[model samples]
Target: MAGKQASVLVQYIAVRGDLAEKWPMGAIIAQACHAATAVMHVFKDDPNTVQYLSDLDRMHKIILKVPNEGELNALVSVLESNNKDFKLWVEQPENYPTCLATKPYIKTEIQDYFKKFKLLK
Candidate 1:
């Protein structure tokens, strides 16, 4: 995977694990938003890319509350852009729903957030 993509994945797993430790929903959402904003900065040259990443991050919060097809599809689109055959990573039954719902959003958020710090660019 690309450096950005790998970073996103690792950060997401860490966040998910942290959230699983009984963190409040609001806190989780805030963290996610921050991460998304950072991720958006990585693609500062393209506003649409930033918007898509932001939206995906927002949708990820929603997905945590309610899993849906559209959100999953959006995530798949983002992942595919970073790594072809990314779906293979999601194929494991244990990882299916959670990864499908959260990975893209977390990645987008992290990128956007870091970008704000001018670290990504």
Candidate 2:
């Protein structure tokens, strides 16, 4: 017998490990927050986002770590090619690319794209 699949929406966040190491913890956390908020604002009208917001308390997100700016750029480029909507947050003045975030998406639909990355530890 086949088991029924569950459709769960997840927000994907990718942060540069180099920045996390070099900067203070609060600064690194701020970058992730900026990316996540930016993506949410950009995709607020999307159905998945709407649904995800409807249950704010239970919303789920998977935070991943990218080794450095090169890896962050590579991930964003792939997301662009696949037409996957995401926000890449760049800190100003300092001119730094810090984090990336994808709008809420069905797990099965986008999970493979992030399979190689590990959860932020």
Candidate 3:
């Protein structure tokens, strides 16, 4: 198994579910986009990111929801403590910390950190 490679790389984005009640859908979606884009740019040189980006059609992303800003804030600490590479996007005009996006990583290695969240449906 020494030479085995992880075939599926996924990026995980977590958004604040409470925002749905306070903001328009477009605004919430934009925040997620900002976080995802920021992390990708920050880790553009990483091997997994490079491989994840190269396959444009197959790029995979899972967006989940945290109950509120408190949950989103806690996730930052969790990711930081675990040494996960990610971007926590704070909207400028309002200085609102909206969401976070993890750099593309092996699903099995990183999914556990996000297991508590539910898909944003």
Error of model 3, residue 1, in angstroms: 15
Q: What is the Cα-based lDDT of residue 121 in candidate 3?
A: 78
Give the CA lDDT, 0 to 100, for residue 49 in model 3.
97
lDDT of each: 0.38, 0.90, 0.92
Q: What is the Å distance of residue 14 in model 2 from its true position?
A: 0.2
The deviation in Å at residue 94 for candidate 1 is 26
TM-score top scorer: 2
What is the alpha-carbon lDDT for the whole of candidate 3? 0.92
**lDDT score, candidate 1, position 52:** 47
Instruction: Report the C-alpha lDDT of model 3 over 5-112, residue by residue, as the tens digit.
Output: 455789999999999678899988999999999999999999999999997998999999999999999999999999999999998888979999999999888999
Using all chains and alpha carbons, the TM-scores for the candidates as numbered come to 0.31, 0.93, 0.92
For residues 1-121, what per-residue lDDT tens digits would candidate 2 score against the true structure? 1222347889999999887778888888889999999999999999999999999898899999999999999998899999999999999988878999999998888888899998887
Q: Mind giving the per-residue lDDT tens digits that candidate 1 earns over 3-85? A: 75543432231134323345566754554455445444544455444444554543322323213334445555754665522
Better of 1 and 2 by TM-score: 2
Candidate 3, TM-score vs. the true structure?
A: 0.92
Top candidate (lDDT) = 3
Q: Could you tally the backbone clashes for each prediction?
A: 14, 0, 0
State residue 38's C-alpha deviation in candidate 1, in Å: 0.6
